[model samples]
Target: MTSGKKTEKYKLILDAAVKVFAAHGFHKAQVSKIAKEAGVADGTIYLYFKNKEDILICLFKEKLGELVEKFHLSIEQTTNAKDALRRVCEIHYGELEAQVDLAFVTQIELRQSSLELRKEIGKAVKPYIVLIEQLLLQGMEEKLFRQDLDVKLVRQLLFGGLDEVVTSWLIAGRKYSLSAQIEGTINFYLNGIKA
Candidate 1:
């Protein structure tokens, strides 16, 4: 197959895998289901990925990379760390809220994978972590955040807090608006980190 066709099929499988994994948790999700969803033969999935775990890993790598770029662009024009931070939260929450299947695959199903798989997925999240850290550093440099802050620790706290809010919303059946919590979440984090 041509390189372009290969890339197209690979993306199709990953997109289908997200839906299958979200609908049926990782271990319960079958390669056949993903293949069926993608409208391809079961064997066709193997052409792009080794197995279910590989599919999940590739999915995270591709999706998270796109999200990191989105987060970067969202804050590129902001003059203040506070606005940048808020933009990050809005984009993160809004993206997840808009794509619940992707949200479930990310927030819930991803957690059910093995430690090795989780670690692989964690690697994909490093760029996002760095983005958060950069925001905090900007806040400190601009005198918007405390100078005595532990940048690394604060990054973890901020990212963890944002992550939990989405997890809680998903766990609760998403009855409420996930994006609506953005302002409150940022406010709570800013209180602890602000100068």
Candidate 2:
């Protein structure tokens, strides 16, 4: 196969793997199942990934890399730190809403992987956290956020809160719109945490 065809095939397998992993947790999800989902021979997956764990890692990197780039570009267009943060929250929640299955794969099924896999996920997660930290620092510099606040702690809080909110929505069967709470949630964070 040409390099372009090979790359397309790899993405097809990865997309199918995401669906399969989301439907069946990692332990129960089989390579054959992913292969069937991808409409490729079971051996084809081996060509792109060493194993299932490799697929999970690639999924995280691809998804999270896109997310970080979007956040950076979105923030660049805004001057106010709070506005930028709100945009970030909006984008994050919007993504979860738009891609519910992928969100399930990410927020829930991904946690079932091994500790080593979790460590790899942590490395992929750093860029997203850094985006939040940069916003917090900007807010602090502008006296919009509490000057005494630890940037790392603030980053954790922002990410943790948003993550929990999304998880809750997913757990609740997505009965309500995740993006609907953006204003109140942003206000709560800003009022309580800002300087």
Candidate 3:
């Protein structure tokens, strides 16, 4: 198990990797570049992570893990299923907006990874998928969503829609408020979900 300081170093490395990866793209971003960005030796990077791919997976686990946690916590504060869904989107876009480098790393750099790397990335993303699945289940339970709807498919739709919108925002240089779309996105989701 990693100690507190070790964990800190790990996070520092991931943070640096985001900037390095975003600036250089995944293939062009070397472990040495990331280590330099993190102010650690390239060998030190291997001590904490096996390779560059490990760093990328670690980064996604760190960021997306936080998103899932925050989404769950925020949902706990609300009773209305629709409100819970909206809260999740708000947190999603707000977190991305709060870190442009991370936004670029996730939205742009991540896509440039290889198919195997992409599969690894998807495995790291299970938490977010399961969270959305639970929320859809809850919405159905509360009679706020269509009972006949497939929770899994609906989850794909919701996550896919939000993901595409954010991708568009990132691609467009974020000229508009990403969080500002919360209401409209929620409305679109509810129109499909509402019983």
Candidate 4:
């Protein structure tokens, strides 16, 4: 069984890995560098992670899992679909705006992984997509969204659009606040769906 100390150390290593990877890129970041950043011995990294790829995958799991859980809570707090969507945007853009390392790793370095790693990352992202679909379905049920609208397509559009906005912002060296675009983003999608 893993002790609380072990769990805490694991998270520390994972957090350090984010900065190391962001600074050096995933391929160039070594286990020793991450260990040093975490203030642990080089061998301690092996105890927590199998390799660099494992560290990257674990980082995705930890970060995205936290975001997905927050999405669940955000949807629960909002009674209306539009409000829930706006809340989602708030969390998305807000998190990116709040953390430079997270934004850099997610938008740029994460995409540098191999196809297999990308596929694994995609699978890990399904829960968040399902959450979006559920919110869209709720809108349809309330007659707030068109009855004939495609939930899957709309979810894809919402996710893809928001993702592109963040990606573009990161690619531009993050000149502006991503959270500032939340309302415009909601209006852009909500315009077509309003019933």
Candidate 5:
């Protein structure tokens, strides 16, 4: 097959893998299921990924990498630190809402992998966290956030709270709009935690 066909096939396999992994979790998901979902032979997945774990890593790298890049680009257009934070929250939650399957795979199934896999995922996630930390620091510097707050702790609280909110919504079968709560959530964090 041509290179273009190969790339498309790889994406197809990854898309199917995300759905299967989200439905079955990493430990229980099998290559056969992913292949069937992708409408390819079982061996086709091996051609694209070394194994299931490799698929997980690639999925995260692709998805999270895009997310980090988008956040960086989006923040560049905003002048105020508070506005940047708001945009970041909106973008993160919006992306998750837009791709609920991937979100499910990311927020739930990915955590079921091995400790080594978790570490690898953490490496992929570092850039995003660094962006949040930088934003929090800027906010603190500008006196929009609490000056005495630990930048790292505040970053953790911000990302962690958003993550939990998304996870809860996903677990609840997405009954409510995750994006709609952004204003209130951001306000609560900014007011309650900021000096």
Candidate 6:
């Protein structure tokens, strides 16, 4: 196959993996199920992934990489650190809300994987955490946030806060709008970190 077709197939598999993993959870999701969802033969999955765990890891790396890129571009459009922070919240909530299956895999299914898989997944998370620190630093430099705040700690808090909201939404059967929480979540974090 041509490189383009190969890339397309890879993406198809990842997309299908998200649905399968979300529906069945990681432990119960099988490579064959993902292959069936992708409409590819069982052996084809092995061409792109070593196993189900690899599919989950690659799925996260691809998905979160897109998220980090989105955050970067959106932050660039904002004039102030506060707006940039708000953009982060909006994009984070909006994207996940738009793709609840991905959210299900990310927030719920990923946790059931082995520690090594979790660590691999954390590699993708680090860039988003770095982005949070950058925003915090920008806020401090602009005198918008506390000067004495530890960026490291604050980044964890901010990311954790955003993550917890999503996890809660997922746990609650998504009865509420995930996007609706954006304003309040931003307010809560901004209040905690503001100058």
How do the residues 162-189 of candidate 6 rate in per-residue lDDT, one tens digit apiece? 9989999999999999999999999999
Q: Each candidate's lDDT (Cα)?
A: 0.91, 0.89, 0.88, 0.88, 0.88, 0.93
lDDT of 4 by residue, 1-195 (tens): 469989999999999998998899989999999999999999999998888888888888889899988888877888898888889999999987887797788888868789998888788778888989988888988889888888898899999998899999988878887888998899988998889
Q: Best by lDDT, which number?
A: 6
lDDT of 2 at 28: 86
Q: Estimate each model's TM-score.
A: 0.97, 0.95, 0.96, 0.95, 0.91, 0.98
Candidate 4, after superposition: displacement of residue 32 in Å? 0.7
Report the alpha-carbon TM-score of model 6 versus the true structure. Answer: 0.98
Candidate 1 ranges with C-alpha deviation above 4 Å: none
Candidate 1 CA-lDDT value: 0.91
Query: Candidate 5 regions off by >4 Å?
Result: 1-3, 193-195
* 75-187: candidate 2 lDDT, tens digit per residue: 88998899999999999999889988789988897667788999998899989998889889889899999989978887899899998898999999999999997987899
Worst 10 residues of 4 by lDDT: 102-111
Ranked by TM-score, top first: 6, 1, 3, 4, 2, 5
Which residue runs of candidate 6 sit more than 4 Å off their true CA positions? Answer: none
Distance (Å) between predicted and true CA of 85, model 1? 0.7
- State the TM-score for model 1: 0.97
Can you write out model 3's per-residue Cα lDDT over 49-74, one digit (the tens) per residue?
99989999989988998888899889
* True-structure RMSD, every candidate: 0.9, 1.3, 1.4, 1.3, 1.8, 0.7
